[model samples]
Target: MLEILTGAGLTTSAGLNAFIPMFALGLLDRFTNLVNLPEAWAWFSSDVSLWVVGVLLVLEVVADKIPGVDAMNDAVQTVVRPAAGGITFASGIGTETTTVRDPDALFAGGAWVPIAIGAAIALVVHLAKAGTRVGANTVTVGTAAPVLSTAEDVSAAALTLTALFLPVLVAVLVVAVVVGLWLLARRFRARRTRGRAAAAPGGSEWTA
Candidate 1:
């Protein structure tokens, strides 16, 4: 089920892809009845809109080009992504009703597990991207470069709302690209690091 949701076709679909994570988050929230504040902000913060989110996402793609900003962005995103995920999940859950059961009871009875799962997934994805950005910065600009990392900040806000109100397709596509980029960047960084190390002094002596 997870594989099917995150696959290329689903991820590429603008409406479904963007909202998948949110839907998952929502389902979890529904089962748990937990109120996550950060997620709330992602959805309600007027400062961070869909347009802003989209712009930030675009900026993140070239974050390595800036340096310090990239690292900062990673740090900020670390906290923001999971919260946003949780909020999206919770919000999504809040939208639906359990027809046969008392809504309050249902919320209290089985929401946390899904919410926790959503949060965990969001955290894992967030950390992976953070790690990737760090690597990209290290490779392209060394450790001291300063790049604006707030690129995704906007996207998070926008995506959160889109997941909440617009078609889920957009959310899924964005998430897919975000995940895909992270994977590609990691592989590229690994290859480059290996090539660089192999070319260094006494390089041949080190066995793989």
Candidate 2:
């Protein structure tokens, strides 16, 4: 379903950066016909909300670019990212005004389902991101901060745009994220295995 895909994309984006999707949704909803937010969510697109979220996004971006600060930011976002994902997913899908011309036909229920699903999706993504970040920071001695943070920000932005314009294409971003996370996880596991082996009774191990 396009509606579900839209939710998936938005939530996935949130997992990477909490405010990017929210800010994009608000701007698009306010300026273009790409999104028609529900009446109850009108405040989300208001000038006040936009400014507030924009500021928060700026702070988040700056903080995420530093190695140690990034880990702390991730700890803080453990709650924010999921909450943002839930809101975006629920709003994007539950309303029949976005995703497809006949969204009403596909989305007949409330946002609770999408919210739960979005939160779960975001939590998994958040954990993967955090785990990989910790590993990368350890391996690169904090030198990977800006590069990885920028990559995540760019990915989030792209995912948000795709979710808004072509909901069906969201699957591509999902697959990419899955693959990236899988590779990172594999590398992390290999490193851990090597660490354990090297510590075990003089197992053959070399460090460069």
In candidate 2, which residue pairs clash? none
RMSD of each: 9.5, 2.5
Candidate 1 segments exceeding 4 Å error: 1-66, 96-108, 142-175, 202-208
Worst 10 residues of 1 by lDDT: 96-105
TM-score per prediction, in order, is 0.49, 0.88
Cα lDDT for residue 54, model 2? 97
Q: After superposition, how far is residue 25 of candidate 1 from its true place, in Å?
A: 14
Taken over the whole model, the C-alpha lDDT of each candidate is 0.45, 0.83
